[model samples]
Target: MRQNRHITSNVGDGASGAVAAPPARPADQERTNSPGLALGAKAAGLPIAGLAALLSARIVTDELGLAGYALFALITTLPALLPLGDLGAGAALLDAVAADDGSPRARAHTRGTLISGARMLNLAGAAVAATGLVLAGTGTHTWLLGTAATPSAGACVAVAGVLIGCTLPLGLGASALAAIDRYHVALLLQAAGSAAGFGLVVVAAGLDAHAAVYCAGPLAGQCAAGAAALALAARALGMPMLRTVAASVRPGQQGTRIMHLAGPMTVIYTTSALTYGTDRLVLGHTTSAAAVAVYSAGAQLYRPAAALLSSAALPLWGRYVQRRGAGGGTPRGELARLVAWFAGAALVVGGGLVACGPPVADWMLHGEAPVGPGLMAAFGLLILVHAVNHPVGMWLSDAPGLRFQARGAVAMTAVSLALSVPLAIALGPAGPVLASALAFAVCVAVPCHRRAFRHG
Candidate 1:
């Protein structure tokens, strides 16, 4: 939940550009890449997804109580930590497809990227599942969150691990849709999944199911959505997006092309996870498990809101990539638009949440861990910092851009690690938020904006 939602936006971020003449829009994608269908769907779906997330949080809090809510948060938030869970292979495919020229060779490259990336994701999934089982066997899962170990905790972690494993590759469907300018299509499907997950959680909680079983609701919805999205993309494009599951694609390329981009991306994701995604751990170990829950009260709203804000701007990344490929970079006007939308969105959403979140959280949390304006404001500040960096971050999401961000991210991680513990100790729930925000704003947002201007 503490993941840098801005950076994660790149993985599935980007919308199709205007329907005007341009070399940026792939000849084949013209029909599906229209702005209305892509962005409109997202604009509509964002609310449902956000609502589902909020309702799910209420369900968890009411049924699971404080401990259950904390566990649920950890399980759901773990995916944000494993940034390289896909081995960055899916991103490689996105770049390939986005930069394609509608030639047979371009199609071939996209195919190769998908097949190879899928192979890597499959392996990564197995490894994660095995590691989860090992952790369960060793009885270390319960102690991971700085809490005492117990049999049930171990079992829960193990189950969470296996579920995460299956989800790793399934996420490629969404990634594929993004590459082809159907990001909004994936977003709509994802919203449906979130809504479905909410229904499942409600039913399960009412039936007295284990908290763990219902936590899987969201995961299952996401998995189904991903698979369905990928299948749709594959059928539309005639690409073997699903062939990686059964080794149907020949294994001749050795997958180096796919790894070419994934390697550096994984490094960036690693640094990002270390620098920004460790919020819960910092609180859990440095403060207490209860502190983690307190943070989630505000974070439950902050994370999704921040992510949606970035996502709304994500299509700009794809547009920039395609435009640059055609020797037409983004307009200065486009930059201004991003700055306005994200900043304004952050202001409105953050303020509204601060004003109203407390009452809603009280109802949702049942007073497990108190939520006040201070915590809400800290996350709001983080969202503002995210707004500052999001536009430039879009331009810097390519291979060379990843390399640049990776260097700064390493330094930011150092600063975050040095200060996160102390801040958590001092500020309770808001300390890490400040530390992360400060480090990113100084070390990341500033330099990236400068670089982007120079690139312009």
Candidate 2:
């Protein structure tokens, strides 16, 4: 049976089938930022921080040339896939701790699970690091990297593997903070880390450091931020990572149950990674590292706007749950309102890309960029499709809804993969974006419209 109540409590994830207990107590509430502050800060922070990271990325691409840019672009994608490293241990850990009711039995169970989960996460990290080692030591570099795969590029890949391994358990610590209602603290640290990492990247690139060092600059920032966050969270939760236990590093029944609950969510993450994150790799293998450079130029423009607009689902989704939960009916016009907001975002972001993209691409890439009207149009449509589709997807909040979302995700993935390679071969950089936009619109968006409007 589905047991973790927080899965539903976190509506942005489209979890359902459980009602949260009332909000935390006053002292408990004081531990985290107020919802207003959290919401408003994200409103301002996401864009600013995204820009900082984008600038750093542009610098990396500019300094690195096509080969370096390809490797850097590929490295940037590692963090997105990090959530999968633990095989659901982190989620299970969050569920176990968040449900704690201050009773001794609950405390013991939470501790054991936390310790075991932490250890599992650590092992998962080491395994990931080993995988990086294998990659570094092997000759199959072209399997994932761009056409400019070099020995140093392999070293950078190993650096990414090590970076991921270190970050995984630290991520667990951040999740622990969230479980205890200290999410804002984690967010603040994250933002600071991004800002700091940008400075570091600029300095290192200016110094003309070696390829591996400069390429791994962002991961270094991540490690520092993660370590700091873990330290703070450990102090708050009184659970030091890897040092607080005599218990065996094995999950008990509770761990198994939480992992089971985490299965569908894992699938959701996997499908998203496959569909949205594989475009660069496809370009690398099917075309050239130069293609990755061109595509990333366009991606840098649209991704921020798409990410910002798509994030609206988090807040809007809660309003739906609150109103519907209170009235025992569908929300009044929330879907329409959200869809309209998304469409507007599409116009501003997508339209701007079409009109101003060429000059901006040239500026960011530090040379004459050859992006055409067709590619810009594809980027616009991709943004519009994702912007509108995200809210509708977030609106589903039940067992069946969850199942439907998973099915849609699977369909979208299949469609994207089926088309991305051949299409990339035919259409160049625009192919994967077009494939994603088409798949999402047809498979996910169409069905979501049926369930969200007419069927309901």
Candidate 3:
């Protein structure tokens, strides 16, 4: 199949002095490229996912108490840090597919190679993660995150490795869908996966299952959903699953190009995982699981808000790529409008949470968890910061600005690591949030935005 091409025409006077008609765009292409429709789909999907997540967290915290909740958080966090074994291939796939200026056969070849590479890498990562977890499980009573190195902990880690392995392909599938202008389908699949995971967690909490059982519910849901999504994407793309997998085994230039993008992205994302993941782990080690629980609960407010901002900006990525490919200038007005809207919405949501979080947390935890005013404030601020900065970050995702953004990520990571430990010791649970907010604003947000505009 040939990629869609837009043709242009110039009007000229004929020998008969007649005007020529301008070329028309294909109807299918027009619909597929509609930014408003794409943005609407993403906006619709994210809230449903966010709501499921919030409900799941509330149910788990209520049923399991702080320590159990902390354990749950740790299980989820560890897998997120593992990079799905592809060294950022998921992101690389998205970038590659979006920026591809090649024949359909070439695109298919690239996708296959990336898919194959990601699977192999995931398998390797899973092995390493399982080994590390098994070692940790056997060596000491308390492993990282203050979880007892019981058989269950090891089992949870193993399950997390599996989840990470599964997530990589699903993410690539979503990217493929987006590449084909199926933004709604991609977002829907993601939302459905998150909802499935949430439902499983809720069921486990209701059954009062073992820690490993509870952890397994979400992991299984994620893996299952990812597989389903990948199947759907393959069918939509008109690609045979086995053939694509087979193609992936052979090395190609497309694969090399993907790795080139993935390399820097891997560094940036690793730093991000550390910045977010290490906070709870540090708290668990220095303080207690209960402290981690309180912090996690407070931090939960940030996710939905951030998701909202992200969903709103997600469609802009394709637009940015399209504009850049066409050698057009950045749409400053559109970006500013989005940033302003996101800031307003964030403030409203953050303010509401600040006012109601303490009461809500008290009710949800049944007084087992404390959501103090200070923690709420910090969490609220974090949400606001993330919301405001989201557009800036999205703008920087363009190829020209990615290097600056990566540098910003590194700086932010360093600052977070430096401040998180001491502040956690001094101020307890509120410390990490404070450190993240400060570091993100000073290091990541500031420099990225500055460079993004300069490049723009």
**Model 3: residue 64 alpha-carbon error in angstroms:** 4.4
What does candidate 1's lDDT look like per residue over 296-316, in tens digits? 777777876776676666665
Per-candidate count of clashing residue pairs (backbone under 3 Å): 3, 0, 0
For all predictions, the C-alpha RMSD in Å is 6.9, 6.6, 7.9
Better of 1 and 3 by lDDT: 1
**Residue 91 in model 2: lDDT:** 53
Better of 1 and 2 by TM-score: 1
Candidate 2 vs candidate 3, TM-score winner:
3
Q: Give candidate 2 regions above 4 Å deviation.
A: 1-39, 46-51, 81-120, 173-187, 228-256, 315-332, 397-399, 452-456
Q: If ranked by TM-score, best first, what sequence of candidates would result?
A: 1, 3, 2
* Candidate 1 ranges beyond 4 A from true positions: 1-39, 148-151, 248-256
Ranking by lDDT: 1, 2, 3
Best candidate according to TM-score: 1
lDDT of 2 by residue, 1-456 (tens): 112222112222111112244333443333223334444544566655676666876777667765676677677667664446455555555555655654456655555566656666677778888888898788565576757576677778788888888777677655665555555566666667767767877887889876677656677777777778767765665444434322234443123344453465567667878887888888888997777878887876776556556544443333333334345455427677768877886888788889987677666667745777678889999988877876676566433555677788899999999999999999999999999999989888889878878755
Q: What TM-score, over all chains together, does every model reach? A: 0.88, 0.78, 0.82
Please provide, for model 3 over 1-456, each residue's C-alpha lDDT reduced to its tens digit, 9 standing for 90 to 100.
Answer: 224321122112111111222233333354335445555765686677657756776676666655666777777656555533346565555565555554545454445455555555555544755665574457542455464233456666666656665565455665555555665676676677778888788778778877766776666666666666556656654444324433444445133455555666777777777787777877877787667877777666566556555665665565566567677786677667777887788788778778877776665456776778788888777777777777767666654466677777789888998999999999888898789889888987777656656657
Q: Please give the CA lDDT of all the candidate structures.
A: 0.71, 0.66, 0.63
RMSD of 2: 6.6
